[model samples]
Target: MKLLQRYILGELIRVFGLLVVVLTIMLVFVGLFREATERGLGPVQILQIMPFVVPSMLPFTIPATLLLSVCVVYGRISADLEVIAAKAAGISAMRMLAPAFLFGTVLAVASFGLTNYAIPWAVANIERIVTQAVEDIFIDMLRTQHLVSEPSRGYSITVHDVQNRTLIDATFRFRTHDHHQITVRAEAARIHFDLERQQIELKLRNATYSNPGADSFGDWDGTVLHLPLPPQIHATKARHLTVADLTEKTKEAVLQDEIGQIQQANEAAMLMLTGDFHQFGGKEYSQLKGANAEAVRNQRRFKTEIHSRVAMAFSCLFFTLVGGPFSMLQARRQFITSFIMCFLPILLIYYPVMFLMVNLCKSGTLDPTWSMWVPNGILLIAGAMTLRKVMQH
Candidate 1:
């Protein structure tokens, strides 16, 4: 029994290792190309980012690779009449699958560890590295030309020219934090770089300002403006946070949003008592609505992300349960066909379902704790049916 288990596990591992390496390389290249085009990053920067990309991609790759490996290895075993020989030796079908099942569980546990820990770090690093590269190019452009345009970041600045700390024909188009568009056109501008603050100041003369939903202001004798040169980059996505961090953030948002609503309600009531009939439609109400929306989104996103990671981790074991048993019923001519039969459906169905569920969970249309596990539940049921049929046969 021990030798049989070793032989089976060895075959599975050998195939699994080869497949993992090939898949990881393919995924890394795809990621590299995608990042290069999106960020306009050079080879050196992409290479620097390659390692960070692998961890996040692994959770997506490992389950499929393991499934393929099991399909190939077990299909060959069943095709070669190994099951007949095993049964002749009084070994049950369940015993034959023991090694593969154990191997799958081990892979699942490892995947869980990586998804829970390494992925968050990798995601954060990838964002930081890419944004830093973008910031470098942005600063360079601002120094060389009197204009630096980044439509994505909502900034377009046109200055007549820059000469030893002075700018002419200067105009700045930018979006405020509240998402309002503002334009500032100045006759003459002086650039001051504050290294300590890591910000740039533009001292404008004879300036005019245009703000969203407001009239224009012009002919200012002097106006001082500060802009974040590189800007502060922060990862606001729940996926970039670990389980503990995400849970805490969700809790904090819930608490803060609730407290804000109570305060807003109290303020509105006081105003109403003072004969203000429009108190409910004031800034407090708007703020409360915004806070509530943000809180609900964060809570849903954080819950979905955490549950999805955990659910994805268990896919290795689930795939093993399905792939290992289903492969045994294939005919000799169906070796490659058998692998495809098992893999293609999963590739199409499982992923799309998982994707849909994740989106639903993130949108708060579904309960994340249950919704994210739907794919796993479906896979589990399918695997159990396959195993039961194999056992009966």
Candidate 2:
């Protein structure tokens, strides 16, 4: 029994390792190319992020690769009559399948760790690399083109020359938040990025500013102007956050919603006591309701994200359970045919259901804690029935 388990496990590991490596490499290149094309990343930036990209791709690759490996190893063994030989030797089907289950359990835990921990770390590093690349691109545009315009950011910079890191005879034009158009001319200027604050600091020397709308002009020996960072550099998605961070953020969102509700309730009571019934449908009340609704959506989004991560990770085990028994049942067919028979349904049914459940969970139509597990539950039932059939025969 010990020898059989080892043999099964060794075959699974050998096949899984090869498939994962091939799949991960193919995926990593696709990821790199996408990032490069979308973010305009150069060779240096791509190389810098290459290492971090592997971890992000692993969680996606592991479960499918494990499934394929199971189909390959078990389908082959069964087709070779080894499973029947073991059964004739008084080994139960469950006993023979123990190694695959154990392997799947370990991979499931690993997949979860990759998603919950490794992914966050990799995303952070990738974002940092992309941020630096954007900064470099911005500086390069200013140096080569001698002008940079960002309509979305409401700013444009033109320079006579870029010497080293300094801009000589620079003119900066921008629109303020209050719709004020202003221009500043500087003898020399330097740009600095404050990533922590998500802002850019432009240090100017011998600067003169003019506001044509206000018909005002000013001069300063030196001053620093702050500008918003590019939107692409901002990483606020819940997927980029760790589970602990998501939990804290979810609590904060819920607390804000509760506070807003309480405030609105108190205001409504005050209006009632003062007989100001007309204020019940006021703009302030409408705004307060909107804010509360936004908070609720945010909390729901965070909860869904947390549950989806765990459910997606455990798909490794569920895929194994279904694939192993189903592959054995198809032992008369080729392993690839068996794999397609098993994976085709998953590709068609499992992912769509999971996607639908996630969207419903995010919209607050369903509770994420249970809804996210619907796909896995389907797989478990199918696996159990198939395993029973395998056992009886």
Candidate 3:
């Protein structure tokens, strides 16, 4: 029994290692290409981001790779009469499947670690690389075109020439936060990226600023302009946050909501005491309502992220649970065919249902703690039934 378990575990590991490498390499390239196309990353930036991209892709690739490995190993074994031989030796099929279960459990833990820790680290490094690349891209564009406009960011710059890192005869046009159109002309300027603040700083020499609408102009020897960073560099999305951060943020949001509710109540009581009932619909009240709504939305987002991360990680175990028995039942078929047969329904049903649940949870329509596990529950039942069949037949 010990030897049989060792043999099964060895075969599973070999197949899984091979499959995961192939799949991860394929996915890493796809990730690199997508990032390059979106961010205009050159060859050097792509190579720099490759290592960080791998960890981010692993959580996505592990479960499917494990399922295929199980299918290949178990399907081939059952087809070759190994299960029958084990049965004749008084070894139950369930006993023979113990190694798969153990392997799945390990992979599930690893998947969770990848998602909760490695991914956040990877995303940070990737963003750092992309930010530096963007700086280079920005300078390159100015060097070639002598003009760069970001309508979405409400800014544009035109330069007479870019000499190395310096801009000669640069004119900057942008909208202020208050919707004021301002233009600045400079004899020379240098740009620096402040990543911690998510802003770009322009150090201008002999600069003159004018408000076109007001027809106002002023001159200064040295002027500094700060512009918000590009949207892609600002990654506040829940997926980029670690589990501890999510939990901390969720708690903070809930506390803010509670405090806001208390303040609203107190303010309403004060207004009623002063007989200013009309103030209930004032701008302050409306702003409070908006803040409360945003807090609630943030809470939902954090909770959904926490639940979905765990659910996605545990999918490794569930995939093995379902695919192992299912493949054994389809042993007469080719291993690839068996793998396709097992993974097709998962692709079609499990993922769609899981995505629907995640969306619903994010919108506050359902509690994610249980809703995110619905797909896993379905797999558990399917695996149980399939294992029963394998045991009896």
Candidate 4:
């Protein structure tokens, strides 16, 4: 039985490792090919940028590899009756299945390390490598002169100084929402994208916006003025930012929004206390107090977002435990059926977990950290129960 357990575990780990390599290679090549043709990135440049892109994919990659490998390894074993023979020899069903579980446990730890450390570093470099390649290409364009790059949105770009991301002279003409012709020309302009704030500031020297009924076409400055933009201004621009950065940015925004509501409420309450509690029958103070209470209620609702992220990350451990027991059950599931069933329970658990998190956030009834992990807690219990059942056989 010991020998058999070791054999099975080795097989599981072997398959999982194989799948990870195969999938990573497949994904990397397919991504680069697709980006080259569909995204208009140069093949050589995408290849150069691939080291950065690959590590960023590991969080999803490891999970997927393990999931498929688990299904295949156990499914193949059961199909061949090796699991049956091992159990018939008086070995505990889950006892013989120990190898896969250990493999999964190792993977879970590795995933945490990759997600918290390696992936972050890789994502940071993704921006750096792409930025380098784009710079070189722009420099070549400038040297060639008459080399114009037009994006699908029909905006023309010509690089004046590649080193500074400076625009020598750029013109943009497009129809506005009000159905009016608009033309923008800027001389000696610099584009600044602020990743932390998810905002863009275009500082232009001698900028001009020309259209009907405008003095100097909205460029009413000596040599330079700044134009600001949020992500909405350029849909394509959002694609360049990494997912982690975006997630963190959203978290910060939600935090700020919640704090603003709290501060406003506190201020309103203090004002009411000054005018209403101390002063007799002040109508304005009464109204201000009412507004303050409404803000308190709204603050509850806005805080839900802050808790959602931790929930997503922590759910992995719970799900792994659940999968462990499920794989060792009576009348073990087929690979495809197991996968399909896995998602059904996941979705059902997800919505309720989300609902509870949101409610907890709104009511300030529970700590967000604990509330976010409620689904994980439930899965942990379910897993233990399943493990007991499998051992009973």
**lDDT values for all models:** 0.80, 0.90, 0.90, 0.59
lDDT of 4 by residue, 1-393 (tens): 488878877877787778888888878776667645543566676877688667656666676566566666666666677666777887776676567667766677666666556655765555445545544564467546724444343334454444456666665454454645556666665655543343334566676777773433666333432323321222322223334554555566556656665765676677677764553246554555556555555444434443444455445555556665565452344676775565567668765776777677668787665676677677778878877886765
Which parts of model 1 have CA positions greater than 4 angstroms off? 146-236, 282-284, 331-334
Clashes of each: 1, 0, 0, 3
Query: Which regions in candidate 2 have their CA more than 4 angstroms from the true location?
Result: 160-170, 184-190, 194-198, 203-210, 215-224, 231-234, 263-287
Residue 176, candidate 3: C-alpha displacement in angstroms: 2.2
What does candidate 3's lDDT look like per residue over 11-37, in tens digits? 999999999999999999999999888
User: What is the C-alpha local distance difference test score of candidate 1?
Assistant: 0.80
TM-score winner between 3 and 4, please give it: 3
Q: Residue by residue across 293-378, what tens digits does model 2's lDDT show?
A: 99999999999999999999999999999999998878844878888899999999899999999999999999999999999999
* Per-model TM-score versus the true fold: 0.79, 0.89, 0.87, 0.58
